[model samples]
Target: MRKLLLLLVCPLLLSAQTPADQILAKAKAYHDPQDIWPTLETTFTFKETRPDGPDRSTIIILDNGISYMKINRNDEEVYEVNGEVAEVLKGDKDKARALVLRNYYLYLWGLPMKLYDKSTPEISLAEDEKVGDKLCKVLRVVYEEDTWYFYIDDFSGRMLQYKFYKDEATGKGELITLEDEIMVDGIKIPQERSWYTLPEMKYLGTDILEEVD
Candidate 1:
């Protein structure tokens, strides 16, 4: 009886791990069809829509870790950064804004693909969830700084939306919807992201990928 119970429990434990692995594999394939994160070279235009003000646009060129970003709001030529060295080619630039812009672009552009990186958070399967009317497979990612929940489409395996908590214990978080998709170098990327405060569902701004190369 003891041996039989052990045998039964082993398969159950193994089967439990299978779903998360399968979900991750499908998501990776959908986002990075060619597996081109390491050598990804592309240029795209990012536009931010504000609730109280006019829209802002920036042209961003990313070649792996090196990037060149140009903002239309200012006369500051082009801000270029290669590894640790950063500089402006034409006019006065705000270093603080440049840093934030660099992280903002890189993080958004490298989605489900970047989640697979070793330095990123550890990903595990969470209870199944629903985003609006769509049923999704929930993925719980625990990073060093915060916890994030990702909702992947049940049928398509594409990432539909994600949420991050400001205070995990209190369940205070924000949800971001990934809407629209475009292909860049065979990889499918979310073209627009709309953010909202969780629970209350207050509307934030949207980031639009206007152009891509």
Candidate 2:
């Protein structure tokens, strides 16, 4: 009788740690050094050399928790992706621009500043250590039925990488990985990035940033 009682109480004695709390703690510990991220917003330039391509021009802009974005590419048309087709542009940089913007927004906007809210579900630590040099805390977020995974830097509170996945009958889920970092003006930046549609084939992309502050 005592053994049964103890066994049931063991779980209750264990601290209730949710995924969101785990991620928040990890990020806070990692980024205890910088306040720069709180003001992150600017245009990012992409020097694209993908799966098998030479190079191209691309630019992305993000402002105010990233409610808006604009893209311009050398050989592509400008099309926006914001839970829907946001807009279109007719210019030489439209295609490449839109591609970069879509990918960038997909990669960035899916994160959390205050995750205790109900919008993010499955808030706990996941066994996802393949995204970066340090261990990553995966936070499963859901807003209005749409969900995503945010990979945070364990040693630095900054969000160094993010991924979006969806299961479909015809097409498989895709994976995007961020890596090859360099510090520019005290801010860590991604020097090289790769995207895998089937977790096999990867498209290499570059980020060239210029400070405007």
Best by TM-score: 1
In candidate 1 the C-alpha lDDT for residue 121 amounts to 60
Candidate 1 C-alpha error for residue 160, in Å: 0.2
Clash count for each candidate, listed in order shown? 0, 17
Q: TM-score of each candidate?
A: 0.81, 0.54
**Tens-digit per-residue lDDT, 27-51, candidate 1:** 8888887888667888888787979
Model 2 spans with C-alpha error above 4 angstroms: 1-19, 28-39, 65-68, 75-106, 109-122, 128-135, 142-163, 168-171, 182-187, 199-213
RMSD of each: 6.2, 8.7
Residue 14 error, candidate 1, Å: 11
lDDT against the true structure, each candidate: 0.78, 0.54
